[model samples]
Target: MAKILVLYYSSYGHVEQLANAVAEGARAGGASVVDIKRVPETVPEQVAKNAHFKLEQSAPVATVADLEQYHAIVVGTPTRYGRMSSQMAAFLDQTGGLWARGAFNGKVGAAFTSTATQHGGQEQTLFSVIANLLHFGMIIVGLPYSHAGQMSVTEIVGGSPYGASTIAAGDGSRQPTEIDLAGARHQGELVAKTAVRLFG
Candidate 1:
């Protein structure tokens, strides 16, 4: 049974929604186990803002050991000033030990993100995530244009040829559109399937 890790940091729940969709897709693609973990909030107010989900208590803080058990990893984060959030950046930075040991060598990695606007650097965020994976010697995967929904522009609401993403409205009231969810799921499935092919 292959395991895939869905790790993310969400300040407003938008990225959490994307992470759930990605996990659903990965499970559908036959990953026997899916580990969903969230980065811990360093500030009390930030934790309070996310009280609805109790993310502070329920979202496990991922460690380098947690990363090693998975055959594939899908990282998610909210777009922060055209990049991944500082929380995620800090988490990735701690992977220096893993990088030194080539702990992620040949493993499959994918990225997902949510932004407050349509052009809020979702692609850039995904790229930044992929860049770290590259440093760790991981194989990065992205959504392919051949997926059924990919051919339909209506299904292209979020995510891209590079990775998954969501256009989270500024107010954070608008949920991800069906297309956005579908694209995210598809990206997860792609990553899972690729991991199986490469590592199984």
Candidate 2:
């Protein structure tokens, strides 16, 4: 059995939905333990509320030390200017000690993200998060072509060979679609399965 952690930073709740789907998939993929947690919010509560951010997230905030306890870690974030949000970046930046210790070495790592538009650099954001995981000496896993839903032409969905994603509208009115959530689940399942094979 693999222990998996779904860690994410969601400003408008879209990534949070994907995080939950990822956890669900990990459970279905034979993981004995799956925990979903969110990174700390960098913005002040008043600012977040003024900006209409989803402030009442249910997942407990995770600390840098938490990364050491998981066999696999799946990260999710929203794209900010074709990169990861500062909140997520700030949280990951604190992992330098873990990097030096190789605490996550040889573990499974995967990334997922959301963008405000179809051309909003979803893949770039995924890479940004994956790059941090690489620095932690993790084995990278990506959303593969086997999840054929990414090829759908019927809808404006988000999923790439880099990772699963969803296109949240610019006004933050759009939520993840079924296809987007499925892609997140597929990536999570793959991550968990890979961890089981590597660690078990």
Candidate 3:
């Protein structure tokens, strides 16, 4: 019974939708406990409201200590200039204590993200998240080629061997397509399966 946490920070609900899909796949992959949580928003309340940020998210705010309880942590965030959003980075930065004690040394870690365009640095954002997981001594799980959907050239899709991703469009109108959500699910399931085999 592996415990998996789908941790994410979504500014426009794009990544949130993918987070939920990831949780669903984790459950299907035999993880008994799958929790979806979001990091705290660092932007000022007024600024967030003015920017029309999605403030009505339902996931509870995750604390640094929460990372200790999961066998695997699947992270999601929106891309900001070829990297992860500052909100997600700030939250992960607080995990220095966990790194010092190797609290996550044997855990499985995976990443997912959303971008504003096809070439909006989705892979770079995933690498940024994976880099943090590596520093924590956690094993990295990417959206592997086994997903198959990542190779599709039929439609405008968001996925890669690095991780699952979605194009949110410049105006924040385009939502994640079905293929994007499927890739996220595949990555989450793989992460959970790896954790179960390694930790259980």
Candidate 4:
């Protein structure tokens, strides 16, 4: 069995919901332990309190050192100007030691994200995260084309071969749909199964 880590930084609640779905899928895929963690919030307290959504959900903060304990890691973030949120980017920026030591060389890595609009840089944000994972020499496990939901033409869903995602709407009024969560779950399962095969 493989130990998988699903770490993310969600401001409003969309990414958090998707993160849970992803974690559940990872466990369903036979990972022995699925630890869901969050990168610390860096915004001002007052600013965060006035956000359009609540931070009702949270998880333990993740440290770079913890990466060594998991065979697979799934990262999630909300898009910021067609890129990953500053919080997630900052968290990942601290992995110099891990990178220096090749701590994640053989681990499976994947990413998921949420954007404020349909074209709010979803692919770019996911690719940015994947780029960092590659810097650590980790094996990239993307959402495969076999996930039929990724090709849905009728529904407004979020996901691609790069990873999973959801549209959050510009005003933060939108929440993740079942289709979005399903895509996230599928990505998690794929990464988990890959981890079991390669690292278990």
Candidate with maximal lDDT: 2
Error of 2 at 23 (Å): 0.7
For 131-171, candidate 2 gives per-residue lDDT tens digits of: 89898889999999888999999889889999999999999
Per-residue CA lDDT of model 1 for 1-200, tens digit only, reads: 67899999987778888889999999888787888898766557755665543354456777766888888999999898889888899888887777788889999999999898878899899999999888888889898775455456643367778887777787777778777788889988888788878766
- TM-score computed on alpha carbons, candidate 1: 0.90
Query: Regarding lDDT, does 2 or 3 come out ahead?
Result: 2
Model 4 regions lying over 4 Å from their true place: none
Give me the displacement of residue 39 in model 3, in angstroms: 0.5
Question: After superposition on all CA atoms, what RMSD does each candidate show versus the true structure?
Answer: 2.5, 0.7, 0.8, 1.2
What's the C-alpha lDDT at position 82 in model 3? 99
Listed per model in order, the count of residue pairs whose N, CA or C atoms clash below 3 Å is: 0, 0, 0, 0
By summed lDDT, the worst window of 10 consecutive residues in model 3 runs over 147-156
Local distance difference test, each candidate: 0.82, 0.93, 0.92, 0.88
lDDT of 4 by residue, 7-44 (tens): 99998888898999999899889898999999888887
Model 1, backbone clash pairs (residues 3+ apart or across chains), number: 0
Clashes of 2: 0
* Poorest stretch of ten by lDDT in candidate 1: 147-156
CA error at residue 1 for candidate 3, angstroms:
2.5
Question: Which residue ranges in model 3 land beyond 4 Å of their true spot?
Answer: none
> What is the clash tally of candidate 3?
0
